[model samples]
Target: MTQTVDLNADMGEGFGPWPMGEDAALLETITSANIACGAHAGDWDVMAGTMALATERGVGIGAHPGFPDLQGFGRRRMQMPHDSLRNLVAYQVGAARGMAASVGGTVRHVKLHGALANMASEDAAMAQACYEGALSVDPDVIIMVLAATAQQEAAQALGCRWAAEIFADRAYNDDATLVDRRLPGAVIHDPEEAGARMVEMVQAGAIITASGARIPTPIDTICLHGDTAEAVGIARATRAALEAAGIALGVFPGRR
Candidate 1:
């Protein structure tokens, strides 16, 4: 079992006057923040506010770049040329890096969001394009990849600094892909249940699938969604559970 791990959550996903997620409350429990860029959700003000809060809390800040699908919250799949995908990621990541720097913080890592992430998790070429784009902007920035997926494969091929992440509130299929959100029992809502699952996965050093399959992989971080009150509770509980299990929670040491 890994002795240390990082907890991260997606935040700053609001646009204009609209708000999404309990970012402030989530920040109290997570060690890293993946702030949304304008392409999917969030504007300059939202990004700045999120970055400031993360800086104040002494948490690692990361860019969460996704497709330009604000209406779908970037969850709708879209096909595009690999070069365009690269440019898209680069633009969002650069914007996030600047926002963080303006607030006396820096983007320590980059994580793909929504459909882009889902697509990349299965397409090594796409994942590589996205990571290369991020690296082009800042070679030192860590790439946070979904553990045991093509996202991890791309990062390994690039030989760049990276972190492996697993979902704390989502069910995984036998193939390590997330179960469709519309499916029954796809998203775990109970705090205790989420917490216990996280502890079990960390201890087992693998992702326990919905059908009880365990796929071993490096678990550098656990991802929690902050889009709802229940998610915030789960985040807190998961942090406590890890602590109780003697696992230190902190910013991940980007791939050794």
Candidate 2:
């Protein structure tokens, strides 16, 4: 039997009075919800409301932290000292955990968002900063990343559980990283096309990048970015396809 993979989505992007994605609707489809902390695109009310909704749906809760760049939505990288970055990540994770606990649940994992995650994947110094930040907040919270890069290895070495994540709604590079969004055909919005790509990856343990190259990546969790216009539809199709192909979807609990 093929091993099952979890379906996760980044959600809870609302900030202050500005509402973003349909988080409640998306939560119904995803097994894990990476709720945004106040850093990238969430505030107190947003976090609390999202937590309550996710808990009600029985979706696993995760802290989605990013650089403090609300304007760019944390997609634009910001250079900061290692200490500052660590402190910021820790603060965000702590806030999310507190909010989740208030809803009679707790954060199960931590996943960095946007530029912060991309930069930390290969940067040893930055990766350590984020990993330590997570461990400092909750030693047991699994850290999810796009691949098994140095960040993933470092987190494991520190006894922190980590999940190697892959995207079902986007193209990838030969290196197993996501294809640049600026490139043509980077985002897979079509449900059939996206489901086919994901089924191939989960069954064959490889993903064919937009450049037509096969990249082998052991993916434990698949990401479906909720901010996409077709997020809900794509998620539904992807889940149905995976189940049809005999890939059960659930959160990949790490060492903890």
Candidate 3:
């Protein structure tokens, strides 16, 4: 039997003339793209252009919705009511779906971004609210969740199509939460090191925490952050490493 997994990255994060990431170069390596939907870092032009690129690359398209915080880049967590959270997700997914359609593609999945994702990974109810918002717009849309966390729990409870994801360039704590970026060694920077770590985690069929503890879970996809200085390098290296290990890379079929 062969092992297969999806490689995804957040893109379309640049707003206006201030570009971010080597999107064109990175698209050559990833299997799926989580595009920002005019919230944290993208505007209409960015979304449309990105969707077109992802469509051309034959990469699976996903809506990467974050909190409405351009200044903080949605990394700073904000408190909001459950209804507000739900609306935020729905509106973003709807926008992404429309943009994808304009580019002759469609949003096949939804992945929460930044603080929204971090919060959801810790609170099942919060995750549920966000997923519910997405379902309201398109019940069939796949929800991508952080594996072995409250995000997973919420997805399970909702009985929606979902994929469990792990981070390739981020370190994980024993509880499976991502390490704070402010913390030492929280974000992995070396391409080769990031690639090697991904291979180990995929082979182990679990998230290997910073302390070297393994927490078993289904890994449907591995994510590489696109906003890093080494983003493209890490993406290519991770893909090469995975293929070298005889592990196939493909778009994930969300668990139904």
Candidate 4:
């Protein structure tokens, strides 16, 4: 089992007027913050504000780019050519970098958001395209990818800096994909349940699927979705649980 891991959360998802998630509270609990770019949910104001806040908290900033579906909160899937997907990712990541720079922070990582991420997890070609876009912007930027999926495969194939990630608030399929949101028990709302599962999975150095199967992998970081209603509680609980188990939390030292 790894002695240390990084805790990250999605943030900066709010648009101009309507805010989303508890970024303030979640920042207090997480070591890394994945801020959404404009095409997905955040606007320039939100991105700049979130970037400044993350800088103040000394949290590692990540560029989170999703499909341009603000109405769907980037949760709705979209079909696009690989070239378009790559360009989309590049644009978002570039924006994130510029915003972070203005805020006296830096984007150290990149994470695909919503449906785009889900799709990438299943398609190496697609994942490769997004990653290529990010790398074009900053080859040193760490790609945080869903472990044991095509996302990871893409990163490894590219030989770029990357981190393997697992969810703290979501259940995993036996094949290592996330269970669909439409499915019952797909999203774990209880802090205790979420925290306990994280501890177990981290200790096992694998993803413990809903079917009770374990898929071995190096666990570099754990994700807690900030949009979840129980996000704050789950974040706190997960941090405490990992600490109690003698696993330190800090920024992930991305792998090659």
Candidate 5:
């Protein structure tokens, strides 16, 4: 049997007065938290609160750096220069890092969010730029990335620590990439379905797509989207089911 995997959740997307998810409950179920910086849908106050909650719950802290597209939730792709991209990434990461530090915590990792992450997955140049940006911020921070993608390869090549991420609430294509969001059956909304998917990935090291094709992957960490419908329920169920399958969640053991 393979070693147990960690389970992570994207959180802290709330921006002043607008809240999202049951942060406390999600923290209890997840071993790691990818707290959104102000770029997407978080502010300084929200970041501080999220970091504090996660720290108290003993969850590992990760900076979730996204494009500065709060209106579109950082999902809309935009043309950005390498230097601009680098600064944006660094800015968001530092924002989260500062908040975590204030709460007697430290940022353990960095994960690019939304369109930025998807672009980095397929674009070698983008991956290189993002990795360099993350290194500039904190050279030792583990970079969470989609397994087997260009981003993951580039991070490894640069001697940057990384975690191979798999999604519990999303379906994958034949090539192990997430299915298009607009497509039917792209997202696993049912809590039971989401939980089963996580268990299958952990135990079998494979993810089944909507077309019934199995894609092999190393699920070092499983991600549950904190903004999905019934996200709290899904996260709790997925974590519980994974544990029942003998998979215990924790930080991925990577270089400091």
Candidate 6:
């Protein structure tokens, strides 16, 4: 049987006069784009432009909501009440939806970004709060969750449409969490290596940890970071490799 999976990337992470990532090039490679909401790394104009490009490329659009810490690029953790977290997610998703709609696109999924995503992956309650916020606005929006984590647990508990994601440029810990970025070789920069690893994981239908432990989980999507030229290369390479391996690349069915 031919295997199919969605290739996704976090994009639109730029402010005025300062652009981040190769979004235009990535739109050509990825099947889905997790666009940054205004709070963490984007503004209305950026969102609209990115969404328009994705629409033109026939890519699936997803909202990437994170903490309000723009300075830290939403990579720094900040404590917030559960209610506040829910509202924050809701507001960002709504803003993304509006921007996408203005560009004749619609948000098909929601993925928490940066520290918020890392935190939620460890705390089922927190993941539930964020997913609930997205659901409140669009009940059919697919929630992208880290495979085999609390985020997945929360989605299953809610019985909402969801998809599992794995990282293409990141090394994983034995427990399935990402390796600390501070560690050497944690963030992979080699395009061929990244592409090969992605093919291996997708074929295994599991997350192969750094120690070679295969953690079985649904591999619905492969996340490629587009924060740099090398990252974009990795994305393209991964897509090519998947196709060469006879794995079909397309938008995930999600839960709907």
Each model's TM-score, in the order given? Answer: 0.98, 0.95, 0.99, 0.99, 0.95, 0.98
Model 4: how far is 139 from its true place, Å? 0.8
> Which lDDT value does model 6 have at 94?
97
Off by over 4 Å in 3: none
lDDT per residue (tens digit) for residues 1-256 in model 5 = 5467788889999888999877888888888999999997889999998999999988999999989899999999988999888888988888888889999999999999999988888886888788788789898899998876777777878878888898888888776678878898888889988898788777777767778887776678989888876888898888788888877777887642
Assess the local accuracy of residue 8 in candidate 3 as a C-alpha lDDT between 0 and 100: 96
* Per-residue lDDT of 10 in model 1: 96
Which whole-number lDDT from 0 to 100 does residue 162 have in model 6? 97
Q: If both were scored by TM-score, which would come out higher, candidate 1 or candidate 2?
A: 1
Model 2: lDDT of residue 201: 80
Residues 1-256, model 3: lDDT tens digits: 9999999999999999989888899899999999999888899999999999999989999999999999999999999999999999999999999999998999999999999999999999999999999999999999999999999999999999999999988999999999999999999999999999999989999999999999999999999999999999999999999999999999999996
Clashing pairs in 1: none
Clashing pairs in 6: none
Query: Over the stretch 1-256, how does candidate 2's per-residue lDDT look in tens digits?
Result: 6688988999889887789887887888999999999888899898899999888988999999999999999999889898988899999999998999998878999999998988887676788888788779898788887675666666766766788788888777676666677888888889877787889888878667777777676788889889988988988899999999888888787742
Ranking the candidates on lDDT from highest down gives: 4, 3, 1, 6, 5, 2
User: How do the residues 189-210 of candidate 1 rate in per-residue lDDT, one tens digit apiece?
Assistant: 9999999999999999999999
Each prediction's whole-model lDDT (CA): 0.94, 0.84, 0.95, 0.95, 0.85, 0.93
- Residues forming the 10-long window of minimal summed lDDT in candidate 3: 18-27
Q: What is the lDDT of candidate 4?
A: 0.95
Candidate 4: clashing pairs of residues: none
Off by over 4 Å in 4: none
TM-score of model 4 vs. true structure? 0.99
- Residue pairs whose backbone atoms clash in candidate 2: none
